[model samples]
Target: MKLLLITAIEEFEKDVINILKNSRLKAFSYQSVKGFKNDKNEMKNWFGKDDIAVDSLLFTVFSEYNCVDSIYKNINEFNSMQQTVPHIHIVTINLEDENFR
Candidate 1:
């Protein structure tokens, strides 16, 4: 199995979900989280109209490697279409049975 993790601004959560829905994966889990961004990032400090700028961390497991590949492609397409959006990070991890059991 493999784990697909997508981390991005809260505003992009729906876009990520839409991309996931179009993929072969069956389900996923996501939640809000607090994190700091570099001074050069769009979020900057936590004292403006955007507040703390919580991130939406979405993740799921793919039983097949192709699923991960497809999702990464979809995510890249999504990223390319946006110019003003903050940088999002996508990671795919291979999981071993021993790590869980």
Candidate 2:
């Protein structure tokens, strides 16, 4: 088993969900989050603020290795076709053991 963590701006929520479904990932969890960036570009700042906050989502999936690989490949394809920033980000961690009681 492995733990998959996927993050992207809230605007891409539907796209993310579609990717997960297409990958045949049966179960997962997600939550809304605030993404922070300390950009020096004044024009990019909101209301002259130095920091920017973006509405984002974090997806957590526990799955087998093969499923993780499929999800990664699908996300890469989705990002490559985009013509903008804030692309989806995904990572995985190996699960050495688990306990359920």
Candidate 3:
């Protein structure tokens, strides 16, 4: 089992969720997170619109490694669909228990 952690703009949450669902991966956790970009003193837009700001954190678990690439690809496609560049972070980890909350 592995955990795929991603931090993205709040507006992209739904798109990410949909991609996960379509990828057939289940069970995840998320929270509203406030964070800034790597570049400070500069504001950027996702699709050249609203100013950059803190968004959401997306955490999901996958039981298989095979699904990783597909999940990422779908997310990239979704971001492109919205005419926005993908600004996501990915983390893979092994889990000791399924009951973790």
Best by TM-score: 2
Q: Rank the candidates by lDDT, best first.
A: 2, 1, 3
Q: Write the per-residue lDDT of candidate 3 for residues 42-78, one digit (tens) a residue.
A: 4443222334556566655554777788888876666
Best lDDT goes to which candidate? Answer: 2
Model 3 TM-score relative to the real fold: 0.65
Listing every candidate in turn, what is its Cα RMSD in Å to the true structure after a full C-alpha superposition?
4.5, 4.6, 4.5
The parts of candidate 2 lying over 4 Å away from their true place are 39-50
Candidate 1 off by > 4 Å? 38-55, 60-63, 98-101
lDDT of 2 by residue, 1-101 (tens): 88999988888999999999888887999999887767656334222234667788999998877787789898999989987767888888988997622
Q: Which ten residues in a row have the lowest lDDT in candidate 1?
A: 43-52
TM-scores of all candidate predictions against the true structure: 0.72, 0.84, 0.65
Greater-lDDT candidate between 2 and 3: 2
Instruction: Tell how far residue 80 is off in model 2, in angstroms.
Output: 0.4
